[model samples]
Target: MTILQPFSKLLKTIEPLWKIHFEPRVPAEELAKSRTAGSIPSFGFFFLLTLASIIATLGLITNSSAVIIGAMIVAPLMNPILSLSFATATGNWALFLRSGLTIVLGSFLAMGVAFLVTVLSPWDVVGSELLSRTRPTMLDLGIAIAAGAAGAFSLTRMSIASSIAGVAIAVALVPPLCVVGIGLAGGSAMTGVFGNFYVTNLDVAGGASLLFLANLIGITISACLVFVLQSYGSLRKALKSLALGLLVALMLSRPLGTSLHEFAVDNRVQLELHGLHRDGRFRDVNLIHRVDTKLVNGVAYVNIFGAANEEFIEDQKNIDNLDQRIFNAIQPMGVHTMHIAIRIAPIEIFEYRNTSSSYSYQP
Candidate 1:
């Protein structure tokens, strides 16, 4: 009667011979205990990782999907992660530690090399492509969880391991981290390093990078649950742990995330207000969500396209004042930490003119 069992039943009906197991190789609570004991990578592992990083960097630069997929396949970043999940579920702390380290080291190394390559690559700075990888969401976390489960299932069942790996690679693990590092190397060092760019007096931050980490945690937890569900046969215990973990995350994520965001925005505002604070052109403010998470020239930019008016423009005295005010508004939310480009333009409202005034000039 479990929520997932129905889907399992459906799969069995569709393909009676499908080797779906109700229990996984390990239980859930143990997965939480998994850790990475520092271990050196085998020569082969590093070699593949290096190559994959190179290819992924090229793909990022070219903004090519094909190339990116290719790199994902070669990267093989998900195995150790999957192994870590297994180790976690099984209460094998030593294996879990080893696997965790493998994932961290592999992911970081790939990203670092990718950062250098991207910095030197001949490519236009495509913020969207970069931005896409930066922010993760609830949905993304769902994908990670499912992917982890499927991956564990496939590997343990001796099923289509290759296909599962392919799927997991495509889903992502290394590329986003690589992009975060590359964002810094590609002249976004200031914001990228701290993870935000604020140029104007007002802006916000903490949009995407945190989301990426959220997704990672989601996937890890989901995989842990799946491992327990499919392998341990102790559904009661696994459910208990899974429920507790999720409750904790749910309780902690929003406030913690919001506080972090505010801190970032405040930092950005402080930076801008340091030099220019007198006649800044800004006043009452509301943050536009779209351009709130991007960086250019080592500063966060907020888009005031919809908020600008002649008051901030015509009043020369409001330049520094406006900047300060605007900064104050969003600084608490990191509106300046990301892509908070504030453009000064008159608010244009289309007025429907009555034809009666024109009097048919052209007969």
Candidate 2:
């Protein structure tokens, strides 16, 4: 028996409940026709896509989440993607080709529009919104899968079709592609936040493109599965496409896994820093200006910039003890070797008494 035999049997056991609870309100044939029609690249589709791309690009540049969400609502790209998934599931070659072409053209159109906008605009800085899409992890793949399933399910039930907007926001098809355009347009280099884990010269275009590809592949595979499960298509017919999609997702998992590891390490470093502060080791430090951690050649380097009181600055032994504590704290997290540097500047505090009209240095 195949490895899926047990799961298949379990699904069979619940077949009645599945059908009763999840039957599509729309007929499969009608739904397929609707999706196929929507996939056609009409003038209206391109016009709306262009507007969404412009809005999304501006949002990324300005770091406005609300504007990006507005673009997501306006974007028509999701229809073609869903059509592609349905076509793949049903083994409809003509619909597949049409939807695939629409997707490709729409992608390039959005990218081109974004490129032109970024080139013309004076704002060239890569902001938090743009940087967030650059390094996608497996969690992003999970979100795409869930969103794809939700999107397909909502389409089958007209009452809940409005949820498609939320699904579009969740998967984010256009913004990352717009980021790809901005990156290609030679936006300023991104550093400081995401720079510690990656090299100074990170490939902004490549990373955002990978994110878009991940979302695309993830949605296609998952939406196809949902269609098959809803009895809209035959599993045997969809198997080949599903296998190919899985293979691509597998290939993508490598880099995504590495990014996830880096994210985890960064979180751990922050947690350790907070732990030190709570444990009183950082009591003398007034504020932590920045913390940067880099892993290179099997060694980890940590740099901390902070402002501290004069007592911490004057006492060499205290600084040495704190350094040893930080090193010890991070060593247990699987680092081969570690180098730490803490730069601190002295800070002074002042207090004034209104009644006495006098000011005193509180140190």
Candidate 3:
């Protein structure tokens, strides 16, 4: 049999527990009607979608987590996505078309609204919120899968309907669309900006799009799995659709894997720097204000910014001595080549006495 046969057998063995935790709470007819009702397109749905997109775009531009969460709570896109998976699981062609169109059109509408906002807004800086969406790893995929499963499970139990808000926040549908809008609108203007750091909006948009697609596919497939397990749909059809979703997720894993590696490298670089600071006599020197790492031509470059005693700044020999130590600290990491640039700010120390105050300087 297939590699999954053993797992399937295991699931069958725990069928009773699965029913208690995940079985459908509503009748099949009621669930089908609910999905159909949610799939129907209307002006109200589009209006809410547009509003949520605008709010989410603003939130991302301003780096406001609260505003972004608010947008997530208001987003109507989740229903259509769930319905699409449900339709596929049930082999309902009409419902599938209805939900699919809702998702496609709604996504475009959200992106269009975000684009218009970006074109008109004076803010040119890409904030942390926007940048976070541009990088998706396997961790993000896992979150989406878990969120999707939780979302599907929540829907079946009316007592847990309130938990959908948490799912919305976890999956984060609108913000990525907003990032796409910002990327599309910024175009060439996105280069060499404060937050952008010479990365083009097109590149940012592509990454964000991949993230959004991963979330979409992950949610759809996971929800399909839940529906099948709950016995709400055609098991054969659900398995087929689940296979397609898994294939798409597999394709996405390549990039996500690369991103994960990059993330690990960055973390390792930071950890190495932290260890150096802790072990060395560099306690008087603050190297943690800002640290930037960039890789070019197979060599890693690090830029550290912090303040030091003014005396340290004035003595070129002493500064050179410290620089050598910094280099030595990073050498053990096994990087073939690395360049470290240090930016030191002078600090003035003031001593207050009974009569007069004395000042000392260090960099």
**What TM-score fits each model?**
0.56, 0.81, 0.78
List clash counts for every candidate, in order.
Answer: 51, 0, 7
The digit string of per-residue lDDT tens for model 2 on 210-293 reads 899999998998898988898888889888888999999999998887667656666676676677778887777767765656
User: Which wins on TM-score, candidate 1 or candidate 2?
Assistant: 2
Candidates by lDDT, descending order: 2, 3, 1
Candidate 3 lDDT, 1-363, residue by residue in tens: 999999999999999787777644977888899899889888989999999999999998888999999999999999989898889889997999999999999989988999999999987677667878988888889888899899888877778978988999889898898899888888756742332133343366887898899899988988888888888887797767677788999999988876765565567656655765688755556545545555554456766666767776787875576656555655554445777776777777677667576678999
Candidate 3 wrongly placed segments (more than 4 Å): 1-24, 191-202, 284-363
Instruction: Locate the minimum summed-lDDT window of 10 residues in model 2.
Output: 191-200
Q: Give per-residue lDDT, candidate 2, residue 346.
A: 83
Cα lDDT over the full model 3 = 0.80
Query: Of 2 and 3, which scores higher on lDDT?
Result: 2
TM-score winner between 1 and 3, please give it: 3
Whose TM-score is higher: candidate 2's or candidate 3's? 2
Model 1, range 1-363, lDDT digits (tens) per residue? 889999988887877555444434433444333222213356777888898888877776666877777887877667676665555566666666777677778877876887788667765355445556655545565676677677666654433645775565647766676676566565533221111333322111233345546555666676677677666434454455456557756864764455445445544554454333333423322222233433333345544332335554566565555455655655455244444444444554456978766554666
Q: Write down the lDDT that model 2 would get.
A: 0.84
Which sections of candidate 2 miss by over 4 Å? 1-24, 187-202, 284-333, 339-363
